[model samples]
Target: MTKLIIQIPCYNEEATLGMTLAELPRQIPGIDQVEWLIVNDGSSDRTVEVALANGVDHVVSFARNQGLAHAFMAGLEACLKAGADIIVNTDADNQYCAADIPRLVEPILQGEADIVVGARPIRQIKHFSPIKKLLQGFGSWVVRLASKTNVVDAPSGFRAISREAALRLNVFNEYTYTLETIIQAGRQGMAIKSVPIRTNGYLRPSRLVKSIPSYVKRSLLTILRISMTYKPLRFFAVLGSIPFSMGFLLGVRWLVLFFLENGTRSRAPSLILAAILILIGFQLWMFGLVADLMAVNRKVLEDIQLRLRRAELNSNQKER
Candidate 1:
């Protein structure tokens, strides 16, 4: 009897929370053994009341509204503390299907993966906005390139995390937790798998979508941050290569002009630009090497802690 905890994080989602809770038990027969956790992210509405009225197994409330990432972190910490063998995070807006929970966890149950995500197939949703789809595609590409893993859905909230993986995760206090978690899990050598699932359109407009530029900027910054942590060499190499390539091309043109026209300097501006670009590229490459060394040392320290934790777990299990 593996204990599973399903955590729903809500913020002013009273209108759909009841419906979402009602559909869960009906959709997932295994709900009989599962513990339901609803985190009221300081909703102005009756989100907490609805959870209690519906007889959810547990509820946690925040004093004030925190971002979605903070809400999720709190829920995850609660789930781990409750001795849940597996933790599933879903939205409170009823976007995700409870029926797909089993599919999401199947890989984890089979010992094939530590993290499983429910990937919403955008093609199935006729109402999905083109802008949302484009953003998702671009984000997915950035994650895949940075992590060097084929993860189709990096920002999906519907996910199952094994107990071990949950304990290992240390999400930063920011909206970037989604991408950060994926990268961190990869860095920890956790097996990650994705399952195709269908999600309904948002019942109401999401606050997240209101600021397109902000969202894009945050997402790109998160991606860059992850690249710096896990793939510093690649990050710096790409950064350096851009300027170096441009400078080389400019310098080649200058050389061509100078040789072809009786040793005359054709473009002094191009020469200066080329020199600046080349110097900056070299500096970037050196910075990358230093960052790579630091990353290696950090990984070594993390590995030592992991081994110690594993040993403690084994000793405790033997005593039990």
Candidate 2:
């Protein structure tokens, strides 16, 4: 009987909140044993009332709209405080089926993985949007390339995380935090797996498409930031190689031309440009090495602090 908590983050989703809450207990037989936490991200509608009316045990409300990432972070902190051993994050819009909870938690229960993401196969659904399909495909590829992890759905909202994994995650911002989490987990060698799930029809048309350009820009920035934070060596090496290689090739070409023209002078502009590019590349590489050392030192400090905290906990338990 492992303790589990189901966390839902809502934003003015009053229309479907009641139905979503009611369906959860019906779909999962052991629902009584699980805690349901609903995070109201400054909903202007009756979302909180609907959740409370539907018998939600825990509710966290924000005075102002803080994006999805903040809502999820709040719900996660509440779940952890409630002594949850496993936490599952789902949507309040009734997009994910509650019946899939068991499947999502299986990997965590078996100690096979730290995080399990529920991936919806958009192709199997009827009336799938081609634009969404393309974005998902592109986003998946970007996540794979950036993290080097075989995650199929980095943007999926439905996910289950063990207590340890949940505590380790510190998402401070919105947009692409999920992708960043996957990247961080991969860097830490945490096991991750995906479970198949299905999404219900949206109550209203999604505004995601309208924000594609902004989303893409933000996602790329987040990926680069994550790379620099956790895998600086790889990040700098990849970026540095481009300019370095270009400069090297240009320099070689200039030298070959100079020699072929009977010891003529090299192209001054080309030589200067090549020198600048090479210098910039060398600086980037050195910065990455320094960043890597700093990251290592920070991790060591964190480990030491964790050990101290554990010892304090043990002492407190003995006194009790």
Candidate 3:
């Protein structure tokens, strides 16, 4: 039987939590059983009570506000423990149309994708400012380049992951799980696909992106960090090439000036600076090589970890 669990990571969302939960589908065609799991990230409000009252199958609570990334990871764990074969993650504010859950999980159910992301129509979202929409598009483009994937929506929270895919995901960022998870999925060679989906009318301003500047800053940092982590070679190579190219041109200029004008004293500083830049660039390139090697090692370790988790879960199932 295909067991599907829809998880919502909630904060102080007492007022909207009920509305979000009320619309969630209790049944889907391909899924034999559909369950709800809520992660309460230390909300000082009645988020926990609201979840329980909404008939949540499982609820994970944190002692304090641990942030979205932690809450998402916790929810994944709770879902796995509850014997969820597939996991769907959504926002508690009801930004996404809950009716699209079946569409989001369709790719995973058909074995076409290990993870499916519901891409919202950025231009159509009326609440989004022009700048926000542009930034969103730009961010998605950068993620596509960095992750080497075709995902059009990197920051989308509405997504579905198979049990296998969920086991391999690890969130290191404290800000948000949306971008990092996509990068992680891409780096780990998991099959990820994006489907066009519609969103509901804006209920309220996003709590995550309180301001445009803060959102851009945090989102860019997360993307860059993940890029450096997974694709260190590319990251370092690009950075190193700049200095190396400039140093080469400068050194050539110094050499030509010395040969033509015979000005050794004046060109000494230029030559020295050029050599330093060249060395710096070379060292950076070498650092990248080392980081790339370490990244490979990390991938190997992650594979082992996933295998161990699968074995443990199978053993637990047998005992039960």
| 1-320 per-residue lDDT for model 2 (tens digits) | 56688899888988888878876752334333687899998999999888888888899999999888788888877887776778999887787888788888888888899999998887665555677678777887888777677888888888999878876776644753688888888877778898898777766654333466777777788878887888888788888888988999988988898889966775899999999988888988998889888989978876785566446545654675
Q: Sort the predicted structures by TM-score, highest score first.
A: 3, 2, 1
Clash count for each candidate, listed in order shown: 0, 0, 0
Q: Write the per-residue lDDT of candidate 3 for residues 1-320, one digit (tens) a residue.
A: 89999999999989999999999999998999999999999899999898999899898989999999999999998888788999999999999999999999999989999999999999988888899999999999988877779999889999999999999999989999998999888988999999988898777788899999998999889988998898899899999998988899999999888888877457778889899889989999998999999998998988898899888888878888
Model 3 whole-model lDDT (C-alpha atoms): 0.91
Global lDDT of each candidate? 0.81, 0.80, 0.91
Best by lDDT: 3
RMSD of each: 3.4, 2.9, 1.3
The reply for model 3, stretches above 4 Å from the true place, is: none
Sort by lDDT, best first.
3, 1, 2
Pairs clashing within candidate 1: none
User: Which regions of candidate 1 deviate over 4 angstroms?
Assistant: 26-32, 211-213, 259-267, 300-320
